[model samples]
Target chain A: MKIGAALCVLLLSVIAVHAAEIATADRKSGFEFMGRDTQAMQTDDTSNPGMLNVLDGGALWERPEGADKKACASCHGDASQRMKGVAARYPAFDATAGQVVDLGQRINLCRRDHQKAPELAYESRDLLALSAFVARQSRGQPIAIADDARSANALMQGRKLFNERMGQLNLSCAICHDDNWGQKLGGTSIPQGHPNGYPLYRLEWQAMGSLQRRLRNCMIGMRAEPFSYGSSEFIALELFLMQRAQGMAMESPAVRP
Target chain B: MPFKVEGDAIQRSLTGQPGDPTEGRRIVISRQTGLCLLCHSGPFPDERFQGTLAPSLAGAGTRWTLGQLRLRLVDGRRLNPDTIMPSYYVLDGVVRVAPSFAAKTILNAAQIEDVVAFLSTLRD
Candidate 1:
């Protein structure tokens, strides 16, 4: 009887360990939580409204601009070849800038440094198009944000922001996403808030948008003041989200409800 | 108007007069006003979709007294600091409020009274 009781306790502990592992390690794309129609829209390139932005982005990539008359294509050549797997490692620490930068900000840096052009406005058609164009090359690749010592502080800050309660709602991202995901909020099932399919189409917005736009919307919904575009806080949060989404398949220009 | 918090309950209504239960019901279900259904499910049969976050409001009236209900509606955090429910009538200690929502509570004094009146009608 004593041996049997010990065995039962051992089995229970094993089960508890397994549950904890699943909670921390199991990653589900927002795609899984979406409906069949939305899934179909995401899968079919021709049908996906986000593809329109991608197409426009493709055009923007080859068109020369700025004082130096340099298009992104001039330096990078074909995006399919040069930019593949690039988006997977972004929100990276840039030593020159002494800060972390997401893919959109990196593109702006390139335009300023190489193209000698003005920075594109946040959420502008041109910026979204360019980002979508670059990110499309990384579709189907696994997210693999690098572990750099330079970005350690930013990553820590990101993690803090994700767990911190904000606004009048006093709810953290972890409260809904980490704790209560798969539960319904009003009519909609709460998604895990993955960052994989960013620069994607959201039916609620009825337009293609960047991750910053979505973050801002959630803050507004929570009655919190949103961080400005290109803010360090937003970049840090992106770094944390990308790290959290590491190894999830990249699905840029994807669709969401 | 000043009110008093006695233990887990508020002994006085924010508004001097009693609120209409019908108006309270409307505010409770409204997407714009109360936003209660966003994180709470209730006994409304006609509402197709309700939240599954907080406890159901079906037995709320039977669960607590009117004063207790009033305190919760005003600010649940006074009891549970880590609650996800917004402090509908609190304007202090909130940070980074959006420009449009700055210096405003989720519900006004009369609105709080109305919501309390409506919630008080919820019996198991």
Candidate 2:
């Protein structure tokens, strides 16, 4: 009887441990949706349209700005080292602000506080470049945002936004990314919709853009009213996506169709 | 979106309702109105990027009656609540729907009839 009780406790602990971990939506990434030419666009640095933004961002990092006349390099010299693994852990809890902020928000905060510069307009070219530059530094690193009590509410809200159906189309993020991933939708493979490649270039956009931009486009496609950029809703949704895509390698500055 | 769900086969229009197949075809592909191509690949072989979530409409005329097609377009949930396909005409029974989009059907009565007409002509 003692042995059986001990074994039962061990098995229950094992189950609990397994339940605690989150899994990637699927094995395939959105990269699988591209054709050979598009794949070539990502693998070949010269051909990768996203490189344009990254290059532009590298310049921005060194250039001084605002009333404080401070450059990003002035404080965090050599982003390759100072900013390494930064993007992977974003949408992190900002205890000071008592809310979650994604990478974009973090950059904006830096600009506002240190540089004394106005916030970069969302989806602007300069913003996209900076975001791409920052995110690319973390490429190949697996995403692992903090999962703690403070983040519980934000994460749950994000999950609700993802799973809850809405709009004239009456669709949710899960319907495509989770329920029917890899299935064809509009002659295009429904991607897992991971944020690994945001601030990535797209053939359709012909320019670099952030994950929030992509999310807004999806909302329009669903025939729903999209929230403005920097809204708490977008932040919450980004937090959830980061969690959903945990362990997936970051692919910033990625090219997409 | 004004919609009524009845246990019996819902027929909002007659089988032989006057509908233009050409107009219906244009509507199905239009991003604003039909938007059907978002989840359904039809006989539009030339059109790029057709969706494949739902059944292909290659031979839809032979697969379903005009009444059946209209019902599906009007209120797909009534037939199958679990269907991911949106109800093009019916607006009620959906929660968390956008306020601006609320009380508005994706397609009007005539448009639904027109789509039914176009789909009927999809005989292989």
What is the per-residue lDDT of model 2 for residues A1-257, given as tens digits with 9 covering 90 to 100?
85775566567556533432224454556787889898888978898888888899999999999999999999999999988889999898887667888888888888998999999988888888898899989988898897778888989999989887778888888878876777788777888788888888887888788888899899877878887798988898999988888888888888898
True contacts kept of 2: 0.60
Q: Where in model 1 is the C-alpha error above 4 Å?
A: A1-24
Q: List the residue pairs that clash in candidate 2.
A: A186-B49, A186-B50, A186-B51, A187-B50, B1-B103, B1-B104
C-alpha DockQ of every model: 0.31, 0.28
lDDT per residue for candidate 2 within B1-124, as digits (tens), equals 2334444245546333667788999999886778888788887768898887878888988887777787888876655555678888767766645677778888887788888889989998
The DockQ leader among the candidates is 1
Query: lDDT of candidate 1?
Result: 0.87
Where does model 2 exceed 4 Å of error? A1-25, B1-8, B12-18, B29-31, B94-102, B121-124
Residue-level lDDT tens digits of model 1 in A37-79: 9999999999999999999999999999899999999999999
Q: How well does candidate 1 score on lDDT at residue A254? A: 92
Put down candidate 1 lDDT per residue, B5-104, tens digits, no spaces.
8877897889888878999999999988898998889999998889998889998989988899999988876765556788888887777888888888
Against the reference, the lDDT scores of all candidates come to 0.87, 0.81
